[model samples]
Target: MTTDAYDHAAVCELLGAWAVHALPPSEQHAIPRHLADCADCAAEAERLRETVRLLDGPDAPTAAAEPGTAARNEPNPMVMSEPTPATRNAALARILAVRPPAPRTAPHAEPYAAAVAALRALLAELDPQPDGGPDLAAWRTPVIHDWTVQDTVAHLIAADEHLAAHLGLPANHPQDPQGAAAPGDTDWRTAWDTRTHRVIAHERTRPPTATVATWRAQASALLACPAANDPELAARAATLVGVRLPVAEHFLIRAFETWIHADDIGRALGRPVPPPPAAHLWRLVRLAVRILGLALGPTAEPVALTVTDAARSTEWILGAEGEPVRAELVLDPVDFCLLMGGRLAPEAVPRAALGDEAAVRTVLGRAARLAWL
Candidate 1:
């Protein structure tokens, strides 16, 4: 048995033996002394014992059992726990390094990339109408300050190309706007906005011949970006505000933009524009709710979401208008997407779905109050 120099984890393990009457006095006596002095060790002991009890109880386990047996009061051969500080500090260090994901009850994230890929393929297959092509007439909107589908396609492709320049694109990329003569070209905003609209006009005049094929390739490629797999990935210091994001995230956000634009044109064109599959829809809504929370702040309580079709539920906790976001509601995948896209109404959302009602509305902000379809 060790003395005062024992590590916390070993001490915790020893205490388990003592509770069950297996730890010898050499290790056992120090445990009581340590627990008396160390709050962290005591809490850990309590949690571990609770874990073992839950795991070993008769109603819980189907397998041959262990841990419930009485302890042999011998000086345990198992190393004595050195009740010390390293135990907690080590765990904290690992947490800080990995920034591990919080526990999630869902089986898997909705597959956004796959959904985008399918949309891309569908866009590719549409045969143009006899009037030279699928006319842009269906996309024109009378609304104030919103983008159309044509403008969307152009923007997604062009904006990424432009920002990719500072993030490591080749000098010959198509994002270079200023044809060497635009005023205040040095201001990145002026250059990007001017060139973005210019490209939008140019692409509108000569839309991509294999629109779907181009999008499919674009969407599929985004899955391989560095940011998607690594949480610690940070954008280059030189990037602009909206531009400081990973490529996979960028692709998904673009998918949101694309889908919204699709709805816009579809409403005008009078045709059904189905959203992505069940899984991807969940991720889309999940991302939107999270970003909205981050952009704003945490609400008082949790908000619940229910996807009408898949029956998947999500929960989010947002603070105030400008505070960090928390997942306080469980929502349905499809409904969540519709809610965020300037479409579905708040009244349509299942209030009971969110465990906390008052906090939900506050976090959703004006987006929840709109009366659109």
Candidate 2:
């Protein structure tokens, strides 16, 4: 870490933004020069940049358009020329140089894999302290529900425990003294909450680095499992979080919560957490809608639900199977996720609605209740 004039800690914290081309000009100019002399930063930078590449997929166009160039006919300087196979391979080689190849995942698991990568990218921004401890200030920053950054990571460990155990991974923490309650048990939510608190309590007694390592090791094991790379294996259903869903849908659920909590941590640390890649975001959106429909059930009044982003709008009719749609409701996809994640109050979330107000309320309330995160 030999960038003489730049504060190394600040520089390291900005690496995630730099890799995503999100930094302002002054910050961007310092990174490359710093990376030339700093081996650790350089290696971490390559990993974060590679993570972004995977999220965007190999053939997706780079963000080359200039901020104000939408009105211009000239080629945008922001966009890079499309990569040839040779170039793509060279990039992959660079990724391999810095870390092991990312695990192969089928379409269903891809979002979860990319999400794990995204969280890694965010965590990489926390430069180590002078005494060789994890960055305690950043790790202690408060996130949602009285959780510090490290506690949130611990909670994720507990959240993923059921699925991991179902797939034959060993438990990451000791079982409750009374006994580990199955997901099918009558008091499952209590069991789940108790486990999360227990994990957080135990993790608080260890170094933050230890907590992070524990979380990462479990996440890696989950991704390396056969079901993560095979659709047929993920087709098998298991009950977790008090709901029975296929392993594939469970993977998406993992991706959803990971990104949401990452966003929570980012806000606490005063950094921005980019939403998942568009395709991944859509996967989460579709999943939330399906779950919402199920919660609404067959006999409730029908509402036409539309979720939108800049590129498109997707519509679904919720409630009674044969009834005419009694009301229409619209919400942005990100807002919908936040709503379902319990970060947004149903009444406070931005939306457009018409026809029966009560019907729309039922959908929004049910969606909010769906959140266990």
Candidate 3:
């Protein structure tokens, strides 16, 4: 049998984690040998050890006292000591112990039907004041990377139409000769009568807040998506989290996108932003599960998890007892969408939220901002 090299990061993380907290003897013995020859792992172990000491020492009296129970909730360190035959077998069995691939998430209740109604109401109520009050006509037309409010609105309508078509519902507008829908035509077979008013107003007004109108349309279109009708209802719901989502994930993403972006639009319009309902929050958490799956795809081991959003920065973390996380930009739904949509830059992410910079860069490469048609 051939022996493969252990990951240096894993070795260091385990060493560091073990120093602060006891490891199973199996892990404790193996890591010392791995670290003895690995300068990188050794260095990391030193840092983690020092850091843990600080937390467990007088400098962190309060922290140290809190976990004074001395019983760490963590797994045995022996599992990580060395990838020995027995340990490897144990690890493999543990890995396979994970439940089968997650099925798509589906809506537990009638999903935001009221949100759709509200969108239609807002759409009808919307009337872009073409008067250009606070005007922006001199500016260039918004494109994929740099979207003006008008361009954003047009894209929103386009996105709605696309969703409508996918659902096998009547689209608000078919692809025209110039490949453009008339500003006011909104006769999609889906429940979109009121959307026309909003779209027409957006086309005419061309203001900064029109982006809000566009976002509103997007929410409505998602509710009306055809995939929501798929027999594999779970696969149908997952897409809301991303460009390609399964069903269960789809509704959760829908809830997140609608509630979050709607809040953004409210912030722009000076409207009181209602907080997302509790159900919406639950959906976002489910969406988080999908993110974990994506981030941990290449990883073979289980990873402990922590997710942070420097106010909507990235998405999740899923790995093992001590592997570099499967994901960096996964912990937060808001940041995940922004990063995926090219709305935020990598530099905008705070330091604490990222696990491995390379992993984030990889996610970025996979999902770039999309251009409007």
Cα RMSD (Å) per model? 21.4, 11.2, 23.5
Predictions in order: lDDT: 0.44, 0.76, 0.40
Best candidate per TM-score, number?
2
Comparing 1 with 3 on TM-score, the higher-scoring candidate is 1
Evaluate model 3: give its TM-score.
Answer: 0.41
| Model 1 segments more than 4 A misplaced | 1-112, 128-149, 162-195, 207-248, 265-267, 298-310, 320-331, 345-360, 366-373
Worst ten in a row by lDDT for model 2: 92-101
Query: Per-prediction count of colliding residue pairs?
Result: 39, 2, 36
Candidate 2: tens digits of C-alpha lDDT, residues 20-78: 54344444555776776778777787666656566557676654543444634543332
Question: How close is every model to the real structure, measured as TM-score?
Answer: 0.47, 0.75, 0.41
Model 1 lDDT, full chain set: 0.44
Ranking of all predicted structures according to TM-score, beginning with the best and ending with the worst: 2, 1, 3
User: Which candidate, 1 or 3, would have the higher lDDT against the true structure?
Assistant: 1
lDDT of 1 by residue, 297-352 (tens): 44443333333444644444454544443344544555566666656667665434
Q: Give the alpha carbon lDDT tens digit for every residue of 1-373 in model 3.
A: 0112445534532342244333433444556567667786666556544444343444332222122235345433222222222332233222212211111222532334433332222222123223423234422333333444344445456545534444444544434442232322343322232343445445555554455445554554455454543446444532221245654444444444334443333334333334334345435554545564565465534333334434433333344445654444433544544544445565663334345566655444443332112
